[model samples]
Target chain A: MKLNIALLPGDGIGPDVVVQAVKSLQAVADAFGHTFHFEEALVGAIAIDKTGDPLPEETLAVCKKSDAVLFGAIGDPKYDNDPKAKVRPEQGLLKLRKSLGLFTNIRPIKAYPTLIEKSPLKKDIISGTDFTIYRELTGGIYFGEKKISEDGTIASDLCEYSEAEIERIAHLAFKATRSRKNKLTLVDKANVLETSRLWRRVVTTIGKSYPDVELDFLFVDNAAMQIILNPSQFDVILTENMFGDIISDEGSVIGGSIGLLASASVGSDIAMFEPIHGSYPQAKGKDIANPVASILSAAMLLEHFNLKEEAETIQYAVEKSLEKGVVTPDLDKNSTYGTNKVGDFIADFILHAE
Target chain B: MKLNIALLPGDGIGPDVVVQAVKSLQAVADAFGHTFHFEEALVGAIAIDKTGDPLPEETLAVCKKSDAVLFGAIGDPKYDNDPKAKVRPEQGLLKLRKSLGLFTNIRPIKAYPTLIEKSPLKKDIISGTDFTIYRELTGGIYFGEKKISEDGTIASDLCEYSEAEIERIAHLAFKATRSRKNKLTLVDKANVLETSRLWRRVVTTIGKSYPDVELDFLFVDNAAMQIILNPSQFDVILTENMFGDIISDEGSVIGGSIGLLASASVGSDIAMFEPIHGSYPQAKGKDIANPVASILSAAMLLEHFNLKEEAETIQYAVEKSLEKGVVTPDLDKNSTYGTNKVGDFIADFILHAE
Candidate 1:
């Protein structure tokens, strides 16, 4: 098989980590007797400097032509703290999601047994916790009608959700549930918000088609509490964009480190994979940012192509890397290994794993 | 001082808990040599059953005449599971907030040293965690325009915020901060929501007036993660309505049990105090419900009325009760104390402490 992959190593440590993901993907391709064509493109702050646009037209074109896109982190502290700036780095990623019609974001939260002690939660509470969150990315408050008064005293953001938007994501999440533990929990504030009520109605309506999957509804407030109280009870969680943003990050705490989580944003014809962590401007060029999230994202990309065995090999390599302490300082503070070294260790383990 | 307090013991274990809170309040009044007048009103499911309106006009009238209102829990599981019902017990609480203009809700999350082990989080992670959350209670998506399409295919809710609304609560929170740690963290989705941007602008503008108080901003997403990662870093959290509903519950995790939390909703002329937990319908008449939250709420009511020493006495007694293992099952599972018994212990301690 042949795959055309677009690589967007946006800014900061993005380029350094993408290099590792690319090397690991190359190893996966070699072992599986496949060919992967990688096309590199610019995005985020660096693109803004060179092309005057954070997401250049050329980048979008390459992403459109590729089978899948592998993304490194975006943003810089220079752009982050300056609220008065006209152009921002995050706008690029938001635009990419809208242009690509990438509506569904899947973030899997799983606690690793070996790293349980790293969690703020007791081991008994966080262990055996496995759940996937499906967030609607292209709609809701993120893309709503926003207005600031001429006097600048008042501001408003409209949170609107069309039934079609809810239905599409509900269907995708329902299907995802069929393959998992067959339990789906819809997290919303239906008791308070009209949009939430609509979501409940649509998802509950769509639920009839998937009789095998058990369904439950939790108010977003209670859901936030339950996520910490009894994370093991949830299998798949479906929610709107804003709630998703908060809960997915909260979900990262279950793993004890946001640096280890990766996500896949899937649309009809195009999909993109990236680490759940942000661009750490401090770690730029330091070779200390964790690359396992990006490397694991590459594993997800393989699984996207129905190469389950290849994906499992990458996952096993990640586990082995953690066990052997071949990780960045974030994962093993006492270790002397750097980002590239950890990536090299995982890639080599992937190549040699039985 | 002469005080007129309205007591609304809504449903389930509401009456039992309110009874304890009232007893504690009586002890405070006697200790402080204050005259007190008490009026009891009906609300929630019980109100609906008798007057056909969950929040009857008479109940509202009594609350208006009172200096402060004390509320027990509301709602029933019967109404919770039935979505088809038009009127709910919650509507009564919502109506009360709107009518009374209780725009700011203050919930203090404090970890008790004796009860730290009950938390799912490690003791080291949750110990010494003390923060107060000020949630704009009357506006945002909760009161926004909700529309359902004729075909029931689309649902939308408009999240609108005016500068005045944000200003009032920001001031309240800022004032509270001055009395405590002199730090305030405004939680919003400024990166995405127009309403959040409005919030950020207004709060920042207000922040400039208080040079003594250090102010910071956190995206709602990052705030959720930080609440667990480093809860001690937060002193006072000010957020809009919906975000508050979610984050406060998440903050409750640090305190080990939601049953131990209390809240105060204040306006210029009127204030309301209540335990943050809802009616535990299952524990109704079982004598197992925790009354500490309610009793503590009564203590807060005393403080609101300028009875500082009286409030301190009640707080000290509640702490001593916890120290002596004279708590409800929620706080001490091995203890066989009943709801009335816990109230008696607190009341006795308050009298003896004086």
Candidate 2:
């Protein structure tokens, strides 16, 4: 098989981590006897600095012509604190999603046995926790009409969802449930928000077609507590844009380290994979940033293309790395390994390990 | 001091737990030599059942004519699943908050030493966690305009905020910072939502008046993760209505059980107190529901009226009950004590213990 991957190593530790992911992918290609080509493009803060636009026209063109996109972190502290800034780094990623017609984001939260004790949650609580979150990405308040009064004393954002938007994501979520434990939990504030009511109604109608999957609903507030109280109760969680942004980040903690979580955003024509962790600007050049999340994202990209064996090899290598204690300071303060050495171990394991 | 209290023991375990709170309050009144008059009113599902309105004019009148209100839980399972139902038990609470001008909701999340082991979070992560969340209650999306299209194909909810609403809550939260750790964290989605940017702008300007306090900002998604990663790093967290609803509930788990939390909603002229936990219909008549949250809410009511000594007594009595292992089934499954027995123990301690 041949694959052309568009690599967007955005900013800060993104460049560092994406280097490690590419190493693992190169190793996978070598071991699996596949032809792989990688094209690089500038995005986010780096792009903003170079071209004054976070998403450069050339970058979008490259992504559109590629088989898939492998994204790194975006956002810089400078743009984050300036509430009045017109052009921001996050706008780049948001535009990419919209331009590519990416409608759904899937994040799998699984507790690794070796890393369970590192979690803030107790071992017994997160031991067997395994769940996935399907988030609607293209629509909602993020893309809604935003208004500010002429006097600048008032501001508003409209959160709207059409049936088509909800139906597309709801179908993906229900289809995901069948492939998992066959339990789907829709987390929304249906009791209060009109948009949430539409979600509940649409998802409920969709659930009838997948009668084998058990469906349930939880108020977002209650769902927040339930995530901390008992995460094992969930199989697949479906929610709107804003709710999903909050819940999936909350669910990211169950893995003990945000450094180990990966996510995939899918559209009809293209799919993009990225780490759930952020830029971590403080650790940019320190060589202490964890690269497992980016490497796992590469594995997810492989699985997206139906390269199951290649994806599993990368996952198995990552598990072995954790078991052998070859981790960055985030996971183990006493370990001397940095980002490069840890990635080296995984790539080497992929080439030689049975 | 003489005080007139409105009691709205709403539905399900609301009446059951509110009775325990009354027992503790009566004990406080007797021990502290205060004159207290209690008035009962109908609200929530029970009110809808009797008067065909969730918040009847009579209930609002009772609350307005009283010094303060002690609210129990609301909502029934029957109203939860029916998204099409025009009348919901929660409408009672929303109407009551709007009518009474309850704008700011204060919830303090603290990890008690005796109950720390019961928390799902590891001890080191949640051990000394103590923080308060100031949530804007009467504004934002909950009170904003909600609309569904005639064809029911599209739905929207507008989240709007004005300078005055942000200023009032900002002052309250900043004043709170002076009383404890001089740190305040404003949680919002400023990078995306226009309303959040207004919140950041208003709060940042108001923060200059609070020179002694240190103020910072966090995006809601990162805030959710930080709440689990390191809860002790916060002092006072201020956020908009919906973010607060989700965050404060997530923050509730730090104390080991939601059953041990209490909250206060304050306005210009009126203040209401209630347990943060919901009405658990399953435990409604079982005599197995925990009563500590309701009792703590009564203590907050006393504090609202400048009855500091009386409030301390109730808090100390509840602490003593926990320290002595006299708790409901939720906290200690092996304990033989029931809800009524636990309330009796707290009341007995308030009356007799030093």
Candidate 3:
């Protein structure tokens, strides 16, 4: 099999960690007898500095023509502090998603056995916790019509949803449930919001097609509590833009380290995988950032193409690294491994580990 | 001082726990030598059964004439399970808030020294966690105009905010900080939503009036993670109704049991205090429901009327009860104390404790 992958190592530690992910992918290609072509593209702060746009036209073109896109982190402290800045780095990723028609953002949250002690939650609560969040990325309040009164006293944002928007994500989430735990929990404020009621109505209709999966509902507020109290109860959580933004971030805490979380954003034809952590500007060129999330993101990209064995190999390698204490300082302060060393170890494991 | 208190013990265990709160309030009146008059009103499922209205007209009138309202829980499993129930028991509370002009919902989440073992989060993560959430109750997406398309496919809810709505809650939250750790964190999605940006702008302007209190900001998503990561860092969290609904419930996890959480809804001239937990129909007549939340709410009611010493007395007694293991089954499985027994202990402690 041959795959053309567009690589956007955007800003700060993005380049450092992304290089490690490339090494792992290269190792997979060699070990599994597959052909993988990589094309580098500019995005985020670096793109802004070079071409005055956070996402250069060539970068979007590169991504559009590729089989898959592997994204690194975006954002910089310089661009972050300035509220008055006309162009921001975040808008680049947002534009990339919109331009690529990426509608579904998938995040998998799991408690790694070796890192259970690092979690804020007790072992009993966070243990056996494995859940995937299917968040609608493109629609809802964030992209809705925004307005302010002439007097600058009243402001509003419309949280609108169409059947098409709900249907696409509902199908994805239901499919996910069949592949994993056969349980899907739809999180919404249906009793209050018409949009939520629409979500419930649409998702319920879609659930009829997947009779093997059990579907249930929870209000956003109660869902927030249940996530903390008993995270293991959830399998695949489906929600809209805002609720997903809050609960997924809340769910991230169960894994103990933000550096180990990976996310995938997909449209009809294109899917992009990236680390959930921000580009730590201060860690630039330090060789100290964690590369596991980036490497795991590479695994997600493989799974997107239905390369299950290849994805599992990468995941197993990551787990082995944690067990062997070949981790960055964030996961183990006594460890001497840096970003490059961690990537090398995972790649080495992929090639030789039995 | 003389006071007229309206007591609304609506349904299920609502009457059971509310009677416990009344016990503490009566204990305070006796010890503090204050004249008090109590009037019971019908609301929620019971109100629907007796008067065919969730919030009876007479009940609203009683609440209006009172100095303060001490409310119990609402909702019944029968109403909760039936989607076709036109008059939900929950509507009673919503109508009550709208009628009384209760614009701010205040919830204080604290990790009690003795109850730290009960929390799902590790002791280090939850200990010393003391923060207050001031949620704007009446405005934002919950009350905003909701629309369903003619064909019933598209739906929308407008998340609108006025400077007046933000100002009232901001003032209450800022004033709260002066008495707290002198830090105020305004949670909003300013970068995305127009309403959130308006919130930031209005709250930033309001922060100038309270220079003694330090003010900062956090995006709602980040705030959700921070609440679980490092809850002690926050002093006061002020947010819109929807964000508040989510995070406040998330914050409740740090204190361990929802049965111990209390909330107060306040307007310009009137305030109502209630336990945050819902009425448990199974525990309606079982005498097993935890009464600490209801008793703590009575403490908030006293504090609302400038009866600080009375409030402290109730708080101290409740803490003593927990310390002595005089708790319901939720907090301590080995404890044999029931709801009434626990309330008696707290009332006795209020009257006798040094």
Candidate 4:
């Protein structure tokens, strides 16, 4: 297969990590006998600095023409602290998501056995924690109409969901359930909130077509506790934008290191994979930040294209790297390797996969 | 001191636990030389079964006449599984909160030294974790206007908050800062939701009055992660209704045992104390349910009345019981003590406390 992949190495440690991801991908392409082309585009704060536009017109054009996007972290402390700034790095990413039609975000949290003891959670409890969270990106409370009174005393955000919006994501989650564990837990507060009720109603109706999948529901509050108490109970966790935003972050803690998680934001037309961590401005040129999340993200990008064997190859390499302790300071403060060296080790492992 | 207390043992384990709370309170009364009047009221599923109303007029009257109300868990599987049932136990509790004007709910999560290993989290991460969550009980999406379109194609819940709502809870949490670590973390989705932005704006302004209490903010997503990652960093966490519900439950996991959590709901006129766990219908009448939460709730009730010494007496007794292994099956399966025996041990300790 031939593909054009757009690399958005936005800012800070993003460039460093994306380099690792690119190296791993290049190694994967060589091993799998696939033709691949990489096109670089400036985005986020770098784009903001160079062209005075966070999402340059040329950058969007390049992304639109590519087969998929491999997004690195975005955000600068300057932009973060300046809430009044009109043009920001995050806006650029949001616009790209909208333009690319990336409606759903898939975050897969797997507690690696080697790293389970590193987690704040007990090793016995979260050792086998493996679940994916399906969060709707384009709809629900985040994109809802926001209003405040003139006196700034009254403020409101409308959490709305249409049948179509619920059905699309529900189908994706239910269909994915068939490939993994048959249990799908829909987290919502249906007993009180109207939107949650609509979610329950829509998801239940869509669930009928997939007789093989066992459907269950939990109020968001209870789901929050369940995530910590027995995360192994869940397989595919489907929730709305706001609940997803919170629950997925909560899920991040189970893996012990946020640096070990990767995510895929996909729609019908285009898919983008990225690390779940943010741009740590302080770690920019330090060569100390973890590159595993980005490498795993590259692996997710492969899985998105139905390159299962290639994806598994990368995953196995990552596991072996972890097992061998060929890691950065984030995982081991006394480790010998830096960001680039770890990336090299992963690429080397991929090139010589069993 | 003299006080009148109302006991609402709603359903199932509710009765079993409240008996323990009452025993502890009676011990406190004996230890402190305080005159106490006690009243009992029916509520929840039992109320629904007997009176066809979840919140009967007499129950509300008894609560109103008391200085403070002690609430046990509510909810029955029969009412839970039957969605078609109009009168439910939860509705009774909701009505009580409404009629009593219980505007702010305070849940304190504390990891007991002896029980820290029971937590899913590592001992070092959550060893000294202790924080209180102040969740606005009467407002936000739960009480907001809810709607389903005529064709049922769209559903929405308006998450609205006024300056008054935020102010009342802010004052309570800020006041609490004086007794705690003097740090307050406001959890909201300010970067996305209008209500959260409004919260940030209001909290920022109100923070000026609390110059001594270090004020910080976290997006709800980050807050969720932070609770599991670094729970000790928080002192007083103030949030809206829904965020509070979810985050507090997540906080419960750090304590290792959900049955150890106690909560209080207060307004200008009245206050209610309860164990955070729900009625375990399966454990109903088995005398095997953990009674520590209820005993701790009774301690909070004393704290509400400014009986600090009295409250600590019960707390110390409960702690001693845990230390001596005089617990129910939930905390230690090998323990011979039942719910009533644990309550007896705690009460005996209070009676003999120096």
lDDT of 3 by residue, A1-354 (tens): 899999999999999999999999999999999999999999999998999999999999999999999999899878889978888999899999999999999999999999999999999999999999999999999999999999999999999999999999999999988779999999999989999999999999999999999999999999999999999999999999999999999999877988999999999998999999999999988999999999999999999998989999999999999999999999988989999999999999999863
Clashing pairs in 1: none
Off by over 4 Å in 2: A45-53, A75-91, A285-287, B48-53, B75-88, B282-286
Candidate 1 Cα outliers beyond 4 Å, as residue runs: A81-86, B77-87
lDDT of 2: 0.93
The best-first sequence of candidates by lDDT reads 3, 2, 4, 1
By summed lDDT, the worst window of 10 consecutive residues in model 4 chain B runs over B119-128
CAPRI docking class of candidate 1 = high
Interface RMSD for each predicted structure: 1.1, 0.6, 0.6, 0.8
TM-score ranking from best candidate downward = 3, 4, 1, 2
Q: Which candidate's DockQ is highest?
A: 3
Task: Point out where model 4 deviates above 4 Å.
Answer: none
What is the per-residue lDDT of model 4 for residues A1-354, given as tens digits with 9 covering 90 to 100?
Answer: 788999999999999999999999999999989887999999999999999999999999999999999999899988888969889998899999999988899999999988877887887788788899999999988888889999888999888999999898899999878768988899999988899999999999989999899999999988898888888888999999889988998999887888989999988887899999999999998999899999999999998888989899999999999999999988988898999999999999999874
Model 1, position A231: C-alpha lDDT score: 88
Minimal lDDT window, size 10, model 4 chain A? A116-125
Question: Chain A in model 4: its TM-score?
Answer: 0.98
Compute the lDDT of residue B236 as modeled in candidate 2: 99
Error of 1 at A64 (Å): 1.5
Q: How many clashes would you count in candidate 1?
A: 0
Model 3: residues with Cα > 4 Å off, grouped in runs: none
